[model samples]
Target: MTRLVGYTRQLAPELGPAADVEALTTAGAVRVFVDDETADPRRRPALTDCLAFLQPGDVLVVPSAVHLSHAVTHFATTVTALETRGVAFRSLTEPAFCTGDEHAVDPAQVLAAVEGLRRRLVSLRTRAGMASAAAAGKRPGRPTVMTPEKVAMAVELRNLDRPITHIARVLGVSANSVQRALAPLPRHPDSTS
Candidate 1:
């Protein structure tokens, strides 16, 4: 008997109106694995569970190829792993990848197509996000933690011959932060001598 299993990383509100499990059930999935409150692809416990529950001849179905993986390499690796385990894959959104279909399509070809599509989609989304951030006058990286005052204090403490650890302790910051804060200071000529 063939088992149809589904997996998803997102939950209720983020998954939108139709629940993922319900949608998977509608798509003929008998069992579903959902990772609750997990956003990181690397930390999907439910995905691991689904993989563990899989048996030979079972089919793993997902709404989209992205649900399997966001990265092309990781997607390919996952597909290969499934293939090796005798488990087939099907993407409801990308019907070409469906192994259960009557049409005989090369899995490699499907993988390539999905990879190209994922790359384009990721690139488009990234560009859109960057453009939005630029429009909002916001920088793309983490906000600076070392303020000018902190830097000045670090420099002052360094000049006073305070150790990096002591300075960090006094300022409630890391020793690495103290070191980074003092890195740009002009060296005293006497100190260099």
Candidate 2:
């Protein structure tokens, strides 16, 4: 017997993704799993449970292909593993990727390849821009949040035994940022390490 198991990480707290759940139910999902790990989707316990609950002959249905993995590039590898375990995949959005349909070849593979190509093109363009910036003696990527003046102030504040959190609040930055800035600061000879 083929069972459809749907999974989703995007949850609307107010209504709790009622529409997505209803759509999965309407699409014949025997069980629908929600991954509520907002801080880190990769560490979703529900996603792990969903995968563990799946068995051979079950179809893993998703609202979209993006729900399958943290990144589009990982979807192909994940779906390939599912296929290896005798499970199939279906997407509510991308109907072409549905397996067990009358098609000469698996469209999922093609879709995955196409997405990979798109990502590669983006990465190449970004790298080329960064290289050009480097050649012109301009640093690429995000500008430094902390400067020499900020570091000097941070060091002076630390010398006064000010807490990192307090200093961060004053500087309008995170404690972690402040900590990183002060990581290499040589302790005052009179202060305890």
**Most accurate candidate by TM-score:** 1
RMSD after Cα superposition, model 2? 13.8
- Candidate 2 per-residue lDDT, tens place, 29-87, comes to 99999875352645778778888999999999888665566655567677888888988
Clashes of each: 0, 0
lDDT of 1 at 116: 69
Which tens-of-lDDT digit does each residue in 1-193 have in candidate 1? 9888998655222455246678788988998887654345567777888999999999998877766674777777887889888898888777766664354887888777777668755874586577669879998876666788988887777777778899899888888877887777875554531
Clashes in model 1: which pairs? Answer: none
The Cα local distance difference test for each model comes to 0.75, 0.76
Model 2 scores a TM of 0.53
